[model samples]
Target: MADCVCVVSEFRAGNFRRVSFEVASEGRRVADALGLPLYGIAVGSGVSDKAEELGFYGVDKVFVADDAALEHYVAETYVPVMAEIIQGLNPAAILLPASVDGKDLSARLAARLQAGLAQDCTEVVCENGVLKAKRPIFAGKCLAWCEWSQGALPMISCRPNVMDCKAADASRKAAVEKVDAAVPEARSRALSVDLDTSGKVELTEAEIIVSGGRGMKGPENFTILEELARELGAAVGASRAAVDAGWRPHSDQVGQTGKVVNPNLYIAVGISGAIQHLAGMGSSKFIVAVNKDPEAPIFSKADFGVVEDLFNFVPVFTEEVRVLKSTC
Candidate 1:
């Protein structure tokens, strides 16, 4: 008699992240609609003390599988843990965040349990007593709804920031269960572990992103871009050319193969619009592109296009925004 929605937790760079909150809030919604409980499961090293925080997000239960071996994200190590829990719980549904680590974990978990998984899902709805997952396909050009035939629990992964969560009473409490590894069961294992110890912003989670491209001339010009980003409460991003030139870290790239983003404001400086770049950020609400080339492809997608040199423009633009922000 398990009617619950389970969300896998993400713990990295020393703390819980936005994706966990996004998943918890999302799972809670689906669970509430079906009159089911919401369960939040976290796996990692030194992560047990944070279990209480999950309760604040409306989880009826928080499952923590903290282990030194699980310190880094390894699909092989994590999938079995999730599989054991899901099989035992037999919940109505399970929801995972549609993130890089989350995608890897969800895919393997569903495959092991002989269950189906939906990824990059933008919308989910219930129809004819079955839950429907709406996901984009063909490079996000088209969308489709999917339904599965078997498995007691339907599995889904939600795109970040796609759905706003409904506020819940954090005072509510849930069970905190400490589980064993179900060792030798996980099909995968970690080899080399490398965390991004470098203090740089990840594109998906950054609310403000300032991106640049070929128009910046060369690597040195990127410093101006970084400075502007720093002044504006934003993360520095780059187009493929900028990364290929070794001007910026690949982690800062926003594109299909890199990271897809929908930040509140995306500043594209000197990036001549390429379909690849647009594909990643066209959904951004406010796109401001600054390129001297009047016909640069970036302008077609920008809410405001500035036909001026980035070197000549970014400093002044940064100052204006700074002044405006300070006034308000």
Candidate 2:
């Protein structure tokens, strides 16, 4: 019989990702509801020392898989070791972040274990000792609640910034157990990686975001948005139109076909708010839209709206933010 709830914690650059704590907190809730223990799985090179951090978020035990071969995330190498650890625990439900790597890991693990999997979940709830996940469907037009079949293990990937991460209890500690990384020879391996050195927070994890669309006229105009974003300590994003026009890289695109974000504040400058764009960021806590056209669909969904040319308004907004930050 299945017993504990397991959360797969993700780390990068020797630090735990914020979503790791979010999922651990959610896993704690599920574990408590089911009257079971909460376990965390951490796999990476020299990561055993960091496994204890998950305890602050509520994990009762952590399984660490440390190996030089596991430094970089290769689906083939990670899936097998993770599967081995998970099978030993026989967890009732498994939680992972919906990050690029996490999503890949969860999908492969689900297939390997033949478990029921839910992806990009915005909410997870416990009902009658079972876990149900709420996720967007039909281009974010609706939400669907998903549950695993009677005998299948429930594996869920949660969207970042949507779930609340509680304050850590410094006194809490989890029992850490080391497991052999014993990875299989990969069919293919990454020879090298080009890391993002932009020094900006990732869009999916940013608390605030400033996004531009075709109305910005060209890529050069993004400097105005960048200035404001810097003052706000936010990330810069672009609509699909801007990306398609080559004004920004595809990494900055936010839409149904792009990355979904759930930031606390989303500022849309000159964006007309296509359904695809709304599908990605409509779950934001607060939305502010600035567009020259009053009839832009973005205004309908924005908590605050401004009708003005982005060229004229953005500069003034940037200056105001600068002044506010300077005074603070």
Candidate 3:
């Protein structure tokens, strides 16, 4: 009896995250293939006004949960509303961004709905009316293909940057419906939140990344990399060695044991390119590695390699990038 494909939209500062558009674009493809309408579900206090924007990316209709209790992201509050909407619409598949909150929300929703859940999916397709997902497993060592039966509702969390976001069509519009979500008293409430004021783009969503490793000498030297990143409008990343040495936070670490990033351009400064590190960003569209050691393994994978002392090269590189940006 399923008739639609649904997307769970994630928003911050009243703006939809990049993954929202990405998932909606993917959801559009699936809906078209199955001959069903694509719907978007937005949950947050005073978020009804923003739900219609999903239409720009391809959603035909949108469901909104606008309640004070839903102002902040609480799994306890979000799961119930999402479950109610899914049960009402009987969507064949639900797509979510594989963010920290999205991962948590999708898992709990799958359990509550007794549906099959697919996590970290890179690709999604509909074959003969069944939802099939392609996901990376074993820390990107291999990919596994999975399918859901027509009788089962499937919840899928898509990895960031894996799916392309379609350009917004300003002329498109979506019909919105306000859902009455029964939210119970929360056992815990978020009293406050701390914001990252660094102004750097989020690593998972960034199209360009500039990273440093142990060769930068120490934590203080990361300033040069930050300058370069700012000039390039890219995110700053770090290798495990830099993190272990207390030079960078674990949140900035990128590798097999950390976060996986597939940006359009990846610049590795002083990183020796261990197998674990390569496993994380090897899929980058273009790689530029700078290291004084000529035999460093990173060069083998880099589209452009430079052998020079980072201390000497990075400052000059940052200045040149700044100049280039000003000229443009």
Q: Which one is best on lDDT?
A: 2
Q: List the residue pairs that clash in candidate 3.
A: none
Cα-lDDT of candidate 2 = 0.92
Which digits, one per residue and each the tens of the lDDT, describe model 1 over residues 88-125?
77678888888888888888887897767888787888
Task: Show the lowest summed lDDT stretch of 10 residues, model 2.
Answer: 189-198
For all predictions, the C-alpha RMSD in Å is 2.5, 1.2, 1.9
Residue 199 in candidate 1, Cα distance off native in Å: 4.2
* Candidate No. with top TM-score: 2
* Candidate 3: RMSD to truth: 1.9
Candidates ranked, most accurate by TM-score first: 2, 3, 1
- The full ranking of all candidates by lDDT, starting with the best, is 2, 3, 1
Number of clashes found in candidate 2: 0
**Candidate 2 error regions (>4 Å):** none
**lDDT tens digits, residues 172-259, model 3?**
9888999888987878888766768877688888999999999988999999999899888899999999999999999899998777
Number of the candidate with higher lDDT, 1 or 3: 3
Candidates in order have lDDT scores of 0.79, 0.92, 0.89
Q: What local lDDT score does residue 198 receive in model 2, on the 0 to 100 scale? A: 77
As for TM-score, the candidate ahead, 2 or 3, is 2
The superposed Cα distance between candidate 2 and the true structure at residue 121, in angstroms, equals 0.6
